[model samples]
Target chain A: MVKITYISHAGEARLVEAASGQSAMEAAVHHNIAGIDGDCGGVIACGTCHVHVDGTWTDRLAPPGEKERDMLAYIDNARPNSRLCCQIVLGEELDGLVLHLPIAQH
Target chain B: MDIAVSDIERARSIPLDKIDVSAPDLYLRDAAHPYFARLRNEAPVHYCRESLYGPYWSVTKFNDIVEIDTNHKVFSSDASVGSFVLDDTTLNPVEGGIYLPNFLGMDPPKHDIHRQTVSPIVAPQNLANLEGLIRQRTRGVLDGLPVGVPFNWVDRVSIELTTMMLATLFDFPFDERRKLTRWSDVVTTRPGDGVVDSWEQRNQELYECAAYFQRLWAERAAAAPRPDLISMLAHSPAMRTMSPEEFLGTLALLIVGGNDTTRNSMSGGVLAHHLFPAEWSRVKADRALIPNMVSEIIRWQTPIAHMRRTALADFEFRGQHIRKGDKVVMWYLSGNRDDSVIDRPFDFVADRPRARHHLSFGFGIHRCLGNRLAELQLRILWEEVFERFSAIEVVGTPVRIPSNLVRGYADLPVVVHA
Candidate 1:
């Protein structure tokens, strides 16, 4: 199980374990994590499941694709590290990824 | 079964040219006909030849709408596809002209900038701030209805709550709030080309409304400062440089977004109580079920139905090639009812633990900014509706919007068992 930690905008940190190959959002969603809507159902349509990947682990993950980047540009909490978790399929390379969530998913 | 691609393609879009707008059973129900369900089952990405908006794909089924919503670059929400619904009027191709007066009609980057100006004000904190006012206003609106009498709840409750909320957001006089309501309806109404309130009427109202806002801005800019959304926009650095068109557009977005979506949900809630008395009893028995009840109503109503999206590039969904600039309508109303995702998609179950899963607020960056507010309004209105009158019943049939985009009611005659 790959444990993914999330620090909410209010600084509360929670942990979820993804069965390797599940997206971080899918893991968070199955456990009923707050603030991760994934309204488009793991599709990149809605930016509700956005998160900030830790800078240290940025290089480990694939860069946001053109579609993801264009979508991210419209998100409420879009930062330099912003990524739609739906776009990130969980795998072995990402063993312990830490993501920060926006105060709310718009 | 063969796909209806040929028929859909030949028409360019769903043609509503001969739509029976006045037919009782025709305009009402989830879909216009069994044809829609057939399209959903057979060709989820079927196109129709609409009287307005021209040839566009009617994305039925739950999963596909979510798919299109997820891939924004492929299914863009720019102005080209026509923002509202397909009508003889909405299809009138304007020359390099952007339709509607809000940011909902724009593409990504530009939508981002305008969305930012007022986004902060609708955040959780702000919603929390407005909760008290919302409850008071909601109660007042409900109180106005004659308890134990049967009348159109949509008119008395839904429209009232929407107008009152808009008044709170704009911090404007309640009496004039109806003007914003009227203008929003006029703007979003999808009639044939140059139909409804003529462009002359729209332009005149737009100018007057903008001038009113400008005057309010100057007064607020000079007088005692406050913390309303309008003041926030007036003092916003980004708004300071916005062109008149952008200003009008953003304001129109806020007005329409805050108004129509919530009103439909409000009416939907009442209609839900009438349609499924069992669900009503479930909530009434356990008052704590109000929150989930609000969500269920939103899901069932799908206030904002299919949003118009223009394809930015060539793409394919389920093996059908979609060329660049093709109009794609992501019908959230159909997607919210996706059977695979939501158990008993058609049933109104308040206790569905995941009651909040509905795409009523839309998805992604364009999700309803005032969703929390909309929920708050519904929550309070239901609490009051249930509290003030216990055994309410629908004495007559419910009326729905004539347009395609707003899947809600014009009126729902209900008897409040006071």
Candidate 2:
């Protein structure tokens, strides 16, 4: 199992465990975590699952691709470290990774 | 000028020469697969310099569509961009000078505000409350189907169920619910077609629709705030003061948004079962697949084929020089079939992974508002189908809708064998 922490815009953190192959977005959606809409079901389309990876764990993650990067441009609160959670696949190596959610998922 | 050719015959005989995927007849005959396939393979972002809808760019690949759908800034869906369809309003304005400025046509602040006003109607709480009613209706529609006898599923099942739900959302007169469907059809219908013989008639019908809804608007405005869509629009600060055309536009948007896609999806789901019996059997055996199956159905059918947007500025896209004011069509139908994104894009697979990943409900701020509700309806539908019927067989080929915009069946003959 892979453990991950999702920090809401309000700064409330919720930790959840997901299967190794599942995405962080899928884990949040499955656990009903607040602020992670994942409306497109990890399609890399809707940026509703926008998340800012914690600085410490950012190095372990692969950079966003053209599709994800293009989608991120539409996110109102997108930052250089921001990533769509759906694009981030959880693995044992990145256990306990943290993601900060945007206040609004529009 | 030389001779008249029917769509079906032309579809069968046409060579691979510069295929026009925008041709309405190509879709009318349900023969757009090869055309779109060619586009995806040869030129993902090809430009059609001339067609019935005039010059437009076709973005056929999956990632390309995602780029356009997400970047609403450069690719604007403004009503002036011809209301998200190939019908170029710049070339020929809609008759009666009627342009409804719904949020789908607006950008940023205006779009967000307007969308928020009606968002609560489909909020999680409301959908939870609506689940029981939807299930009851689904049970009624399925249980009432004629067993072992051919019937029009499009009308008996799809239209009946979606129209009922639309009425519930709008709180329109229950007895006069069919009027909603008629108004929706009229709004999407093109001129010179059988739906409306002339543009004048279409405008007249829409005017009547406006007058009827105007009464409802006044009633809702007078009464205390309610949960119905009309009331939401009537009472909300952002929507309350809409111009007549804008009011009509919002109403049209709401009505069609609630009607066509869901209606077509219901029919399309049944047709999917008929087309793929093995997959249907797997889904029938394992109810867990219903949720994913619903997404696959929507993707396979792509009820609304393509949504048009206009280029706000000259830009480079996928190594192509797209000029300002070019009509760009994101062919959701073709994109859904993009093998790069979806595996075995042609076949209907019930257990397909990440099935909810589809372009049918669209993307970004303008993505479908009623998506969850549409899924709930379909989920309950298959649940009831499992309990009631053993087989819902297709009796005849579906009569396809003759428009490039709304890709759906007008008549789908089917029978349930218990």
Candidate 3:
């Protein structure tokens, strides 16, 4: 299991242990994390799973793919590190990865 | 039963190339399901050579729809090229079809900006703020419903609640709220569908709608910015410079978008529970399942049947050559029932896992902006319904609206049992 930390917009940090091969979105949703809706079920179709990866851990994760980037373009208030966490598959390498939720998912 | 069997048989007997799912009568009878199911299995990327709206490509499968919707660069929604609906009349003024250009029919950069302008009204914060009032109104509406006597649920509950919400959003006068409903019906319906006598009448009613909103726009513009839609449009930098036609077009979009979709889903919920009484009992036993059940209701209703996009360039998609300027229609109603993605798609499971994952709201940039608001309305309605009525008995068959675009009902006869 890999440990993932999601800090909500209100500064509440939630930690969840996710099985390997599950995306960060699945992990957040499984743990009942409030902010990440994952409404499209990890398809990267809905931008509800948007999160800003911690700058320190950004390079440790695979970069956003073309589809993810295209979706992010339509999200409101998206920043440089904005990525759809559904595209971020959690594994041993991603352990201790931290993601910050947006003020609200558009 | 006989009609359904014949519809299925007819769907199976028709040649693959001859199937045109855009016929309004098919939807009026609610018999388009069989045809769409066949198309999904045989030709997920099927094309019809001829139809009333002209030949178009239909994307029926769930995943294929996601692909087409997300590939906005190639599949353009620009009104200039082609309107969002299969009918070219929405963009062209010929034949009594008014030319109304709004953001839903525009491409990115422009579409993005205009969408962002009105999006905040339905955003999480605004929805959170509106929840209490919505719940209160819902409770009032439900409490007023006649118990143990047949009533038109569509008129009494669905239309009333949604029209009230629309009025609230626009800050229109409460007493005159039904005008919003009238304008919404006028915007979507044709001359013969019963809403209007002719194109001239439709245009006249719409002009009155436009004039009324224009007055509101002026008043809101003169006053300070408020959270209401009119105030927002009047105050927003990007929206304030809209032309008269653009203003009317945007207003029409909001009215129809916010009104019809949720109204049908509201009625659809009762009908779904009537068809699947077991599911209703399960939900009653577990009140927590209301939210998930709301999602299932939206998927089952799929208020807007399809949204059409024009091909920006000649491209090959799913092995089919889609020529530039070709009309591509994404049948959201069909995709919502694709069994591969949704387990037991035909069944209304109140506790269906991953209920939020459905194609009722289109994917990508042009996704239904008021989705959360719609969900909130349904959720609150169901939650409040649980507090009062034990069951909403569907006493008769629903009179469905006859439109290929708006998949909805005109009347739903029901009796509330306390």
Give the top-scoring candidate (DockQ): 3
What CAPRI-style quality would you assign to candidate 3? Answer: medium
**TM-scores for every predicted model:** 0.83, 0.85, 0.96
Two-way TM-score contest, 1 vs 2, winner: 2
Candidate 3 off by > 4 Å: A19-21, A58-66, A76-80, B1-3
DockQ of each: 0.42, 0.24, 0.58
**Clashing residue pairs found in predicted model 3:** none
Interface RMSD of each: 2.8, 5.8, 2.0
In the range B36-65, model 2's lDDT, one tens digit per residue, is: 877787788988877877788999998889
The order of the candidates by DockQ, greatest first, is 3, 1, 2
lDDT of each: 0.71, 0.83, 0.90
* Least well predicted 10-residue stretch by lDDT in candidate 1 chain B: B17-26
Measure candidate 2: CA RMSD: 5.5
Best by TM-score: 3
lDDT, residue B236, model 2: 92
Candidate 1, residue B330: the lDDT equals 72
Note the residue pairs that clash in candidate 2.
none
Per-residue lDDT of candidate 1, residues A49-106 (tens digit): 8898887877788898876776787666578888999877888778778899887776
Better of 2 and 3 by DockQ: 3
The DockQ of predicted model 3 stands at: 0.58
